[model samples]
Target chain A: MTEHPGADVVIEAQNLDLTFETNDGPVHALKDVSLTIDKGEFVSFIGPSGCGKTTFLRCIAALEQPTGGSLSVNGMTPDEARRNRAYGYVFQAAGLYPWRTIARNIKLPLEIMGYSRSEQEERVNNVLQLVDLEGFGGKYPWQLSGGMQQRASIARALAFDADILLMDEPFGALDEIVRDHLNEQLLALWARTEKTIGFVTHSIPEAVYLSTKIVVMSPRPGRITDVIDSPLPKERPLDIRDTPEFIEVAHRVREGLRAGHSE
Target chain B: MKQVLAVLTVVAVIIAFWYAASVPMNIRGVLVEAERAGEVVDPPKAADRRQIDEFELILDNPFAIDDTWEQERPRLPAPHQVAEELWDTTVEKKITSKRSLVYHAWVTLSATLLGFAFGTGLGILLAVGIVHSKVMDMSVMPWAIVSQTIPIIALAPMIIVVLYSVGVQGIIPKAVISAYLSFFPVVVGMVKGLRSPDMMQLDLLRTYGASKAQGFWKLRLPASMPYLFASLKIGIAASLVGAIVGELPTGAVAGLGARLLAGSYYGQTVQIWSALFGAAILAACLVGLLGLIERAVLKRMGMA
Candidate 1:
C-alpha cells in the first residue's frame, strides 16, 4: 500500500485532524486520519454516526478545514482543488432549490462556472439522460418522488462533468428497495464515467457491495481502523454480494469495527 | 367567483347595519328640531312615549327611513349616502378638479408609492447588512424594533414641523413619514429570508466555491421572494396610513387626510365616510397589485 504506484494518488491525507470548538468544550471529530485514494477508485467511508466519515468527506470537498496534518486532492490543496472545480458534491438531502426547475437546478454549477447557454443546455440534457430522468426537466423538486428527487440531485452533481464525485450518505434516506436500485445504477455509472468516487455510508452491505476500497472508521476521537482492498473483479453484479469472497470482506469490515470499539 | 360572492355578502351585511345604526344615532337631533319647530306640541313622558313616539314619527312620515339614510350630517352616515358622495366627488367631478376624490387620491397615492420604493430599497440594503455582519444584526435590529414602538401619530407632527422649519414641506415630508412606517416590515422579512437557507444548502454552495455575492444572488435572494412579497404587502398598507397621518398635521387643502379634516370641521359625516372608504379602496388596490406580481414571480421560479 505504501509503495502504491507513484503519480496515481488522487487523494492523500496524512495525520488529518479536525477538532470542533463548541460551547461545551472541544470535540475531536477526526484524529490521525490517513489514507491514499488512487485514480478511478470507488472508496467508501463506513462508520457509525459521529465517526467523522461525513466530516472527512466535507474536508475533501473543502467544506470543513482540517486543523492538523496534510491533505491534498489532485496534487493540490483541498481549497485550491475546490477553486479549480475538482469535484462535485452530493449531500444527504437532495438540496435542490425549490425555486428552480429540475433542469435549472442541474444547470446551477455550470451557470456559476460561466458555461455558455448552448453548452449548459447540452450538458443538462446529457446528465439528465445519464441519470435516467429524461422529460422531467421542467418539473419542480416537490413534484417528483423522493427517489426521483435524489436522482435529479445526482444529475445536478454530474452536470458539471467533474472528475471526482464526493457523496455524503446520498442514499441514506431512501427505502431499502430504492437504495438497492440506486446502488446498482451507481456502479454502472462509475463503470461508464470512471470517475474517482468518495462515498460515505453507515450500511455494511452497501459499503461492501459498491466500494473497491472500504475505510472502516470508529468514533470517540474518530480514526480509520481498517482499509480493505476487495479481491473482487471490476465487472460486478447484484449477485456478487452472495459470493463467499464478498462475505469474507464483510466479515473483515465488521471485525475491524468491533476491534476498534473494544480497544 | 365564490370569493367575490362572499365579499359582496359581507359588504351587504355591513351596509344594513350602518343604515340601522344611523336611525338611532340621528333620531335625537331630529326630535329636538321637531320640538323647536312646535311640530310636537308637548313633550310626553320620556319612558312612556319612547316606543309610541318612534312609531308615530315613522307612521306620520313614510320617508323617515329614507331620511335616516340620507342625512346631511348624520352621526353614522348610511353606506348609500357615503357611496353617493364618493360618486359626486369622483365620477361627477373632473379628475383634475380640486373637489374630485380622484385628485386627492392621486396626491396621497404619489406620496405612498414614492415612500414605498425608498423604504423597500433601504430595508433590503439594511437586511443584507444585518445578515452578513454580526455587528449590524446586534446593533441595528434592536434599534429597528425600538423605532416601531414610537407611535406614528406622535412622530408625524414632529416630523412635519421639523421638515417645515427646514423648508422641506409638501409631498416630501409626507413621503418621509410613509417611508418611516413601511421600512420595518421589509427589514424583518428580508432578514429572515436572507438567513433561510439551511446549513446543508450553504455548505453545498461552499463546496462549489461560490462567493458570498453568488450565494446571496442565487440562493438567499431567491429564497427570500415569498418573504419579500409578504412584507411588501404589509409595508404598502402601512405607507398609506402614514401618508394620511402626515397630511393631518400639515393642514393641507388637498389629499384624503385633508378631506377627512375638512369633513370633521364642517360636521360632514358623509364626506368623512367617503374619504375613509377611498383610502381603504386605494390600499386594497395597492396590495392586490402586489399579490398579482407575487403570483407571477413565484410561478416563474417554480415555487408557486
Candidate 2:
C-alpha cells in the first residue's frame, strides 16, 4: 500500500487540525487527522455528529481552513485546487435555487466557469441523464420530490465534471428506502465515472456498502479511530450487505465507534 | 367574482356614509338659501339655527334636505358631487383644456414615473454596493434610514428651491422630490434580498471559484426579485405623493397638486375632491401595474 505511486494520490492530509474560536471559547472541530485518498477510490468518513467527518471533508474542499498541519488536493494546496476547480461539493440539503429550473440549477456552475451556451445545454442534458432525471430538467426544484431533489442536486454537482466529488451527508435527510435506492445508484455512478469520492455519513451500513475504505472517527477534539480497507469485491450488489465480508466490516466499524465513545 | 363583490360592497358602504354625512355638513348653506327665498323656518334667525342640532333642523325642514347634496360649494362634498365633478373634468371636458383632469394627471404621472425610474436605479446600485462592501453596509444604510426620518413634506420645498436656484425647474424639481421619497424603500428591501442567499448557497459558488460579479448576477440579483417588486410598489406610491407635494409649494399650474391648490383658494370643494380622487386613482394604477409585472416576472422565473 505504501508503494503506490505519488501521481495516484488525489488527496493527502498530514496531521490536519482545525479549532474554531467562538464566543464560548475554542472548539476542536478536527485534530491530528491524516489520510490519503487515491484516484478513483470511494472513501467514506463515518462517525457520529461532531466527529470532524464533515469538517475533514470541508478542509479538503477548502471551505474550512485547518489551523495546523498540511493538506493537499491534486498535488496542490486546497485553495489552489479550489481555484482550479478540483472538486464538486454537495451539501446536506438539495439547496437548489427556487427560481431556477432543474436544468438551469445544474447549469449554474457551468455558467460561472464560462461554458459556451451550447456546451452548457449539452452538459446539463448529460448530467440529467446520468442521474436518471432526463425528462425532469424543465421542472422547478419545488416541483420535484425530496429524493428526486437530492438526485437533481447530485446531477448539479456532476455537471461540471470535476475529477473529485465530495458529498457531506447528501442522503442524511432521506428515508431508509430512498437511501438504500440512492446508495445503490451512487455505487453504480462511482463505478461508471471512476472519480475519487469523499463522502461523510454516520450510517454504518451505508459507509460499509458504498466505500472502498471506511475512516471511522471520534468526537472530543475529533480524530480518526480506524481506517478499514474493505475485502469485499469491486462489483457490489445491494444484497452484498448480507454477505459475511460486508457484515464483518460493518461490525468492525461499529466496534471502532463504540471504542471511541467508551474512551 | 367574490373579491370584486367584496370591494364593491365596501365602496357602496363608504358612499352611503358620505351621502348621510353631507346632510349635516351642508345644511347651514341650504338653510340660508331657503331663508333668502322666504321659506318657512322654525328657527327664525341664522344664529338661532346654528344652536339647534343639525339633525333636528333636518327634521323641521324636511324639504331642504334634498338641497344638501346639490350645493355648489359645501363644507364636505357629497360622494356623488365629487364623482360628477370627476366625470365632468375627465370625460366631459376636452383633454387639452385647463379644466381637464387627464392633462393634470398626465403631468403628475410623468414626474412620478421619471422619479421612480431614477429612484429604483439608484436604489439597486446602492444595494449592490452595500452588499459587496463593508464600508457601504455600515455607512450608507444608516444614512438611508436617516434620510427617511426627515418628512418629505418638510424637505420638498427646500429641494425645489435649491434646484430652482441652480436653474433646474419644472418636472426635474418635482421628480427629484419623488426620487427622494421613493429610494429608501428600495435600498432597504434590496439589501435584504441581496443578502438572502444562505451560507451553503454562497459556499457552493465559492467551490466553483465564482467571482463576486458572477455570484451577484447568478444568485443575489435573481433572489432579490420578490423583494424588489414589493419595494417598488411602495416606492411608486411614494413617488406620486412626492410629485404632488412638489407641485404644491412651487405653485405649478399643470399637475394634480396645482389643481388642489387652486380649488382650495376658490372654495371649490368639488374640484378639490375630484383632484384627490385623481391622485388616488393614479397611485392605484401605478401600484397595480407593478403587481402585474411582478407576477409575470416571478412566474417566468418559476418563483410565483
lDDT tens readout by residue for model 1, A83-152: 9888999989999999899999998888888899999999999999899899999999999999999999
The 0-to-1 C-alpha lDDT of every candidate, in the order given, reads 0.90, 0.93
DockQ of each: 0.82, 0.91
Top candidate, metric lDDT: 2
lDDT of 2 by residue, B1-304 (tens): 9999999999999889989999998888999988988988768689999899999999988888889989999889988889899999999999999889999999999999999999999999999999999999999989999999998889998998999899999899999989998998999899999999999999999999999999999999999999999999999999999999999998768899999999999999999999999999999999999999999999999998
Report the CA-based lDDT of candidate 2 relative to the real structure: 0.93
The segments of candidate 1 whose C-alpha lies over 4 angstroms from its true place after superposition are: B1-9, B41-67
Pairs that collide in candidate 2 are none
lDDT by residue (tens digit), candidate 1, B158-270: 99999889999889999999999999999999999999999999988887778899999999999999999999999999999999999998876799999999999999888
Worst 10 residues of 1 chain A by lDDT: A1-10
lDDT at A224, model 2: 98
Q: In order, what fnat does every candidate score?
A: 0.88, 0.97
